[model samples]
Structures are given as C-alpha cells and as structure tokens.
Target: MSENVAPTASAPRSLHGWSTEFRATFTLAWPLVIAQVAQNALQASDVIMMGWLGPEALAAGALASSFLMPFFLFAAGVVGAVAPLTAQARGARDIKAIRRIVRQGFWAAILLAALLLPVVLQIRTVFSWIGQDPALAARAEEYIQIAVLMLFPALGVIVLRSFLSSFEATRVILVVTIGGVVVNAFGNYLLMFGNFGMPRLELRGAGIVIVLTNIFMLAAMLAYVLRHRRFRRFNVLIRFWKPDWPRFRELFHIGVPMGLTVLAEVGLFTAATMLMGRLGTDEVAAHAIALQCASLAFMVPLGLGVAATVRVGIAYGRQDREGVRKAGWTSFALGTGFMAVSALCFLLFGPAIVTIFLDPGVPENRHALALAASFLAIAGIFQLVDGAQVVAAHSLRGLSDTKIPMLMAIFGYWLVGLPIAYVMGFVFDWRGVGIWTGLACGLAFVAVLLVGRFAMRERLGLLDRIRL
Candidate 1:
C-alpha cells in the first residue's frame, strides 16, 4: 500500500497528554465494548435457555458450543485482519487501499465460511470420536445442524464491523447488536417453548433463532453500509465478484496466522471442554456455566483491544512511534485495570453469578452449582491474565506482527497450559478446578511474552517501513 503524509499534531504525546489519550481511547472504546457484550449476551441467553431444559440439555449445548465457537472465532479472526489493515490505510489517506482491503475482507469471509462450515457440521462425529457421550452428541448435533447455517452470515458481519470500526463509527454496531439480542430473546421464548401455538423445538429452536438473528444482523449491517452517506463514496460492494488475488493473498498472509492464533487459545479451551466431558455430566455442565460467565467478563478487554488495534494502526501508518507507544500502553492500562475489578467481582460473587445460568432451587442443579462456583473463583484469578494477554496480542496485531504472537499462543496454550491441565486434573485428581488453574497459568505465561514483545517493538523491527 501507498502512504500519504498525514500530520498527528492534534494527538496526545507527552505524559501530561496521557490523560487526553485515555479520554480519546475510552470514547472510542465504550461503544465497541457494549457491542462485544451484546454479542456475547446472545450466546449467554442460549445457555440460559438451554438450562431451562435441565442439566443434560445444558451440557449438550455446552458441547455443541465448545465445538462450534472455536471454528467461528477462527473465521472471524481471519476477517478481523481487515481492521488494522484498513485503519493503517485510513491513517495514510489511501482511499483506494481501504476499498480494496474491505472488498478482499468480504472475499476472505465468504471463502472461509465455505471451507470451515462443513467441519463444524460434523460435530457429532467428532464428539463421538473424542469419547463424548453418544446421547449428548446426538442432542448437540441437532442444534449444530441448524445453527451451522449462520456461519456465513456471522463471518460477513465481521467484515462489515471491521469496516465500520476503522472509521470509529461504532455506535451503529452497538445499536444493531443489542437489537439482535432482543430479537433472539423473543425468538427463544416463542420457538423454544411452543408459545403462541408454535411447536416446542427445544434445542433446535435455539439453533433456529441463532440462525435467524445472525441473518438479521447481516442484513441490517449491509443496509446501513449501503444507505449511509459516509460510506457510500467508498462503494464497498462496487465490484463484489472481481478477483483481487494480491489483496486476497495478503489477507491470508496476515490473516491465517491471526486466525490460528485465535484457534490456538480457543482450541485449548475446547480441548479442556473435551477433557471435562470425560469427567462426567456435572463437570461439563458446570464448566459451561462458569465458562459462560468468564466469556462475558472478557468482552470489555476484548473491545478495548479492538480499539487499540485501530489507534496503534493509525499511528503506525503515520510513522509516529511515540503515538504507537502511547496507544499501546494506554490500552494496556485500561484493559488490565478493568479486569482487576472483574477479578474481585468473580471472587466475591461466584455463586450468585452461577445461579443466573441455572436455577439454584432445583434439586439436580445443586452439585453442578457448587462445582461451578469453585471453578468461577479460579476464573477470578484467570480474568486478570486473560485481559492482559488479549490486549497484548491485539496490540501486536496492530503492528502487523502476527506470526510470533501465534507461536506464543501455541506455546502458552498447548505446550505449557494444556499439559499442566492434564497433569493437574488427571494425575493430581484435582478435576475441574485443577484444569481451570492450569489454563490460567498458561494465560499468564503468554501475557508476559506478548507484552514483553510489544514493549520491545522497536528492537524487534515491528514498526512499519515508513521513515519519519
């Protein structure tokens, strides 16, 4: 891509300016934060609904989610490469480059969907091979079969989201996502329980609602992009079918590892879920509830990381090293600072939080409830490392420094984390709590490496080619 010299005179610089930087980052980050929470709320609602059908249904939903989410997140991560790339282009004032990046992003999302959706569709077979309960696998398969259709629409939304996020026009994303959650809740109510004479579809109804909600979100996003005056000039869809292989290859060049980085961490969790499945139904069910709570807490830092990608990306494009430094550290502070509060909440309120997913009044729910509360207490410690690692990884992504971070994820999650989990949970007989603590240790390791890597960006040559 080509760069045009753009001034960053108005941006905050000195230590005194850190307050201004913090304000600006928070201003951009809040909307993105709410949008992330809204999206997670969509899944959390499904988990809550699944709980209504009892522990078996909830465990099955957990298994189905454990299988499908890593695939979806991997695809979304690939599409997310568009954010930093587009932000850099925008900072350089390369309008043509911005258009091409968004176009190829759409291309990448479509192609990835075609390739990955089929893998998720075989959830039952995969679960069976992995020694999951055949009965649970059958139930989970029904949900996967219907919900898997949303894969394309969901990936498409990420492309549009990246396009919108680069310009900081993220209010629409938050608004639309909250709207989608409302629609999903209503759909779950009507479809799941046979309300208003509808057939009681149970898990299938949750899957059906998820598909419709995603389709609705995609359609709504497309409409806003098409209708909005700010975006019309770019003509993101002007020539949708034309091949831009160079940009496409560049997309994968940057995106594939980004996708796998997501896969590595989430795959660790997925593997952990499989291990939980081997323990018993109560373990799996409790893991699902506690995991859902942890995921929801994660949205804030995840959103802040997205903002950091944009801010740092723009600075990189402008060849402003000091700006990059400020952006990275400001975001890092915000992410970890917030998580400290979250960790306290998780520690203080584990039992209360667990009850939101399943009824504590029910006799069968008590054992899982106790286990989930203990697991959640460990997540209190886990939250801090989780926030730090995510923000650090995303900050590196802003530098277009991907491959090493992916390697770091592999090292932390598989080599260090999962092994510890296996030894602690199986060998030590610590079961669920041991598995979670091991995962937290893995996150802590990656957090140290990634943040250290980012801190050494200059020495590492992670800065862009442009000479200031």
Candidate 2:
C-alpha cells in the first residue's frame, strides 16, 4: 500500500485567500470537466450514429439507454464510494486505510457487475411488462444483450478513476476517456455501417462498440496507474484475494445509499422516458435528443461534483471545518455559475443544437425536431438547479453523510417529482412537455434540501462524525 504522504502545497486549504481557493478549485476541476464530457461523448457518439439509422433506431437506442442507465449508475455510484473514502484516507495520511478502502471498492465493483448482469439482460421483459411497443422492445433488447456487458469494465474504470481524482492526477483521466470516445466513434462507424468489410449490425454493433470502448478505457487507466511513480507504490493489488470484512462492510455502508441516491434521481428520468414512450415513438425520440443535450451540459457540474467530493473529503478527514466549508461552497458557486451560461445557451441555441442530432432538412424528422427544440427550451429552465443538486449531494458525500441525503433525494424525486410528472403529463394532457416540467421541479427541490443540509452541517453535527 502507498505510504502516508501529506497533501502537496498546491492542495486547497482553509487559510488560502478567496482567489487562491478559486484557482485551486479550477485547477483541480477543468480536466475532470472535460473528461466527463468525453465520457458522455462515448454515448453521444453512439446517439449521433443511431440517428443516422433513422428515428426508430434512435428511439430504440434511447429506450435501451434509459432502461440500462438506472442500473448502471446505481452500481457505479456504489463503486464511486471509493472517492470519498480514499480522499478522507488521503486527508488523514493513512496509507493502509486508503489501500484497504480501494481494494474493497474493486471487490464491490466485480460483485456488483456479476449481480446486476442477469437483471439488466431482462430489458425486453421489463419493456413488455410496462406496455412498450413490441417491435421497439425487441430492437432495444438487441442493444441491451450486448451493452450490459460493459458494466464490468465500466465499474472498474470508475474505481480507478476515483483513485486518480483523489491524488489530483486527472489529466490522464481526461486523456484516457477522450481516447475511449475516439476509439468508440471509429468502432461504431466500422461496425454499424459495414465500413472496411465489417457487418452492419446496427444497434447490436453499437452495443459491441460500447463494451469495447469501456474495456479499452479500463485497461488504459489500469496501465497508467500501475506505471505512474506517484501511484504504483500503493500496491493495491498486493492482497487482491484477501478479504477485509469490516472494510467490505464499510463500502456497502456508504455505497448502498449512494447507489439508491443515484437510483432515485435516474429513476425519475427513466420513468419520464417511459411516459414519453407511452405517448408514441416520436415523443420518445425527441425526448431522447433533448435529454441527451441537457445531460451533456450536465457533465460540467457532475465533474465539479466529483472534484468537490475529493476536496471536501480531504478537509473532513483533517477535521478542518473551515477547509470543508470553503471547498464545498466554492465548488457549489462555480457549478451554478457555469450553469447560468449553459442555461442561456440552451435557451438561445436549442434549435441549433437539436439540428445537430437530427437533420432539420428531413421531412420525416420535422415533428420530432420541433418537439426536441421545445423540450430543450424547457431543459434550459432547470440548468442551475440541476447543477446545484449534484454538487450539494456530492459535498455531503464528502462528509461521509449519505443516508439522509438519500432519503431527501427519494422524497424530491419520487414523491415530489414523479407524481407531478404523472399529473402534468397525463392528467393534464400536456404529454412530453408536462413530463419534462416535473423533472425540472424535482431537481430544483433536491437542490434546496441538499444545499441547506450542507449549510447546516455545523449546526446539525454533520461535521462532527469523522473517525477515520
């Protein structure tokens, strides 16, 4: 295992000037931000290609993705517990604990991938149970059967990526992920279009590309971490087969709620997708385009949220109250500020953006294209809150405080958001637009509760529980 090493001088501190804090946060954040975009691009590239196969392919891709993601994100969130655990260990300068926590994180990833495999392979059944069109469900099943295999490599990548982020060596993360995006695009082009004598398997081809891209990313990240002088000494694989029962339990302790927290949020969106599906193929496809655009923009805050986890976890481990406060709020401010710009971009350029995903010149796509533009306009409304909620939820995770936030997310998303969506979308006969409005409200609701929880951390003793 790596030895206890003090944070480098460049690490953020409570005593630093405001300008220093901003610079420190930005320096830590920019690579992660780009990496998140590139990570999403792996799928965005697939979406663009699926668009070429026409609306049916695009809608089926969206259906498969929505069905797959709630499970994928839940499992990844469990493995993602590594970031806060490793960061706090880094903060307290505990070499042994960091190695142990990370080892268990890997174990958790492998176990989770195995457990979820059978469940996600049932995508077609779930779609049928939920009353989706038989043809769409069957096409989507073709993608699911292959794409679900990515879970193993994807979760492994998250484990390693969390470790890399803790040490602030994120440039390689950005490089590896961007490389995955490029490779995935190339693979999709060859496999999906029969280029270079390859078979045109369409959605199945896209699924193969997804799995291969994730495996390449996992392999690349592993190679770098193993060879990098700064990380190699950790020897995380030294006892890869040994079981540390307590540490394993601790991973589930923090990870399950984190997983459910992600599930609640993703479930809301997935449910909305189902509702759109009920409305018709064009509704679902348009929802996919607009949602993809919003999700791409969302990668910014999601990156900042990752950075906040490390920064806040470090301070929490050191028992530096002021350090934790500065780190959390600074990240929150930066996230919301960036979203302000994105909101305007969505409002102003939504039609232009939608055009990139679907040709405005196509007669067949005109209705879906117009609907996507309208959905983007609504997506613009929730940008700030969407950004705010992620940063706040992650900041609390840094405190090793997740259970309450999990409940809060459930309340806001399920009890609050889904009910609204049903009423507005179905009861009100508003269809897709009404469904999206509920999503915006749910995000906004979670943002308030989480940020307030952070603001009250001291008063609530949320900051007093550190025992690493």
Overall lDDT per candidate, in order of appearance:
0.88, 0.89
**Relative to the unseen true structure, what is the C-alpha lDDT of residue 251 in candidate 2, on a scale of 0 to 100?**
84
List pairs with backbone clashes in candidate 1: none
> What are the per-residue Cα lDDT tens digits for candidate 2 across 1-468?
111223344433355656776787788889999998887778778889999999999999999997888888999989999999999999888988888888898899999999999999998889999899999999999999999999999999999999999988899999999999999999999998889999999999999999999999999999888888888888888889988889899888898999999989878887898899899988998999999888888988998998999998988887666678788999999999999999999999988999898888889999999899889998998999999999999999998889999999999999888988899999999888999999999999999999999988877888655322
lDDT at 134, model 2: 95
Report the C-alpha lDDT of model 1 over 1-468, residue by residue, as the tens digit. 112224345432333367877987898889999998888788889989889988999999888987788888888989999998998888778888888999999899888888988888888889888898999999999999998888888998999998888888889999999999999999999998899999999999999999999989989998998899998788888888888888888888888889999989878998899899989999999998888888888989999999999888887776666778888999999999999999999899999989997899999999999999999999999898899999998888888888899999999899999999999999999999889988998999999999999988877778646463
TM-score of each: 0.88, 0.88
How many clashes does each candidate structure show, in the order listed?
0, 1
